[model samples]
Target: MANRLLEVSDLEVAYGDVRALWGVSIHVEAGSVVAIVGANGAGKTTLLRAISGLLPVRRGTIALGGASLAGPAPEAIARMGIAHVPEGRGLFRQMTVLENLELGAFQPKARANMRQALDKAYALFPRLKERAGQKAGSLSGGEQQMLAIARATMSDPKLLILDEPSIGLSPLVVQQMFSLIETLHRQGVTILLVEQNIHQALKIADYAFVLKTGEIAMQGTGAELIADPEIQKAYMGVLEL
Candidate 1:
């Protein structure tokens, strides 16, 4: 049987009167990479925010490892082993690369495993290790985005949620990022990827969900979704590999 690592059921999130997510439901199996793809304002970022506990869930439940995650603070959720690398690469600009990475292990246990995490992060992004002492703000856009993801991985979370990692990155760098995500998947990290880069995301994902206007529009195995004609026309453009 497949181990269900994370589950979100009938999830609803609203900003006062504006409903951003409406009954969004998805599941992540252990050690699997799941992609959530959609266009702008399609609730992709909102879904991540809700799962990370950064935004309030107006209804429904989120469970991680079979435990309820409802009403938890972002920090508390982090401690429960869900690391979120939000949209816009939210790295502390004034801080050094090392300092920014260290913040990922803010929890006591994650802090205790800091050395191991640091080594892993360095291995995943050698550029980060080379620029450890340099300020985060000094790096290029792609490097900054890489730093954000490396920092999140420093926590060694059970689930890594990334939002639009390829945004603002060059094609070459985006390829590298996707390669690293694949490597992480092989190392047993369950991922919930929110991205607009459909082709790249599907290439590395085991399963995929399409979010259209806050609800799940379609879902299937990566290969199945890639083969679907409607998905090809709407989200993936052409069916060419």
Candidate 2:
């Protein structure tokens, strides 16, 4: 597709003798939210890492805006406009919230747009603006997730990759987090999210891919999968009484 923003085709990644992802392919169109979900060890995070250039690609290709994006350094990937907010938030615990955010603008292109980006970040998460002077480590769990996402926005990325945004968050916070994702989608950010919260992820995603044993086992529109009997049983934890 001419407007496809991110594409991963037959992507394979390995660690030592163990292969984490084998021949996985995904296509994300521009201006949409795509979700990847599966049981633990399904290689969802591995795919994001490969696309962001944190891990080397053993095979296949990842393209953003029709250009190869998986061959560069992690910093170079940021410059190419793929922002990955990893599984653990990955903030500098010792640094102030503002400092951690400033670090995300490390790439030359991002640095040049830092001011406007910072403004946009703060606008999205006002709690972050209040905590700008406080250390990232000191923030509450929900606030930390907010900062992680806000920091990524500082890079002015074309694609935002979020891994497990609901991890450690309260039920109320998870709802709020999902709300923010909806807002981001409305604001024109193309998002690729991996989450254990299958119900929530599918609710907002335009498309959903179910990963199993390091490969895409199922693919469909969000509503289609949400209603599928197999998906409902496997991932939804559906209880038939």
Candidate 3:
């Protein structure tokens, strides 16, 4: 528990009258990959939004590096070592790829490391360097996803939170994307990923949680969850005789 880089306990969030998350608790250990998988509208996005301080928490708590993130603004959260790549690959469309990455290091600490971070990102994603001058909106889907992840690294985040990194990609591209995620973990990055690609997510995750209708349905080591008959039946469309 003390080693957890990101912790959310009994987290509840809502959008006006509608509740999106209900008492969801999850934790990511330092330098490990943890994943949350759920169907659409199952409160996965709400949970990430609350953790990143983009949405207000109606109840519960989010803590990073053992400090509470109760009411900090989104930018404050980013400076405190959390980088969120929300769904839809939120990018500055008209900006050049290099420019988009530059914006990620706007924080004082991040700015200090901007050059090093840019170099590091380019190292991890060589294609980004190849297309550094291209407009972000003109990039292909896989390239755009790479830019999103690369830009998040520009902040020098302690906890990198990714939402649906595998959506809308070819199988080969998805494999490549997962390889980058795996590489990030191998090089000492703590990640909390939300993905609909259940098989690949579990395959790469150290731990996995299943969310349904605003609640955590199951939590276990990725292998444990993957082997569970109920999980296989529901998420993987497996049938038991």
Candidate 4:
């Protein structure tokens, strides 16, 4: 059996008096891609926020490699090997691409290996190397997304969490984004992804969870879910004639 790298058990989260997630549970295995798919209001992003410690958990537990992630701040969480590339591709707008990437390795361990990490990042996204000196805000949408993923990799995370990575990109660029994600997985980064592109997400995932109104509505292997008739109609846009 594959070792679980990250686990969320019976999680409940709220914003003030309003509950956003209820009894949500999921796990990502080492070196595997796990996807969460759902409609916009299904609380997918809320789940990511809670896992990354951006939001406080109202109830339940989140563990990383058997260690509880109950009290660490977001930056501290990054140092503990979980990098979250948020939905907006949160780059330092006025800073150069290289500078943004350098900031990603601010943690002690990652800082020591910064040079190797930069080399790897550049090799993965050569376009970034070409735009190394350019301001982050000036790059095209696709390039910015590439920089976001590359920056997250600088931390040498055990698990990478991505939120809507394909949002606002052209279809061609979206395809490239998924391909890069696959490359990252092949290079041994366990991924926990929340994507609106359900078909592509399912295609690349080893296991998947479908969220509805802040709860897991379904769970199965990627192949199993893809072949399920209900999933095909609801998520894959398949219509039986």
Q: Pick the candidate with the highest lDDT.
A: 4
Each model's lDDT comes to 0.91, 0.92, 0.91, 0.94
**What's the TM-score of every candidate structure?**
0.97, 0.96, 0.96, 0.97
**Model 1 alpha-carbon miss at residue 59, Å:** 1.1
Q: Least accurate stretch of 10 residues (summed lDDT) in model 3?
A: 232-241
Q: How many angstroms is residue 155 displaced in model 3 relative to the true structure, after the best TM-score fit?
A: 1.3
Tens digit per residue, CA lDDT, model 1, 1-241: 2599999999999999999888988999999999999888899998888888888899999999987888789888898999999888889999999999999888888899999999999988899999999999999988998899899988889999999999988999899889888998999989999989998888888999998988899999988888888888997777667
**Backbone collision tally, model 3:** 0
Stretches of candidate 4 above 4 Å error? Answer: 239-241
Clashes of each: 0, 0, 0, 0
On TM-score, the leading prediction is 4
Ranking by TM-score: 4, 1, 3, 2
lDDT of 2 at 75: 79
Q: Candidate 2, TM-score vs. the true structure? A: 0.96
lDDT of 2 by residue, 1-241 (tens): 8888998999999998799998999999899999999999999999899999989999999998888986788877788888899988999999999999999888887899899989999999999999899999999999999999998888778999999999999999999999999999999999999999999998999999999989999999988888888998898877342
RMSD of 4: 1.6
TM-score of candidate 4 against the unseen true structure: 0.97
How displaced is residue 121 in candidate 2, in Å? Answer: 1.3
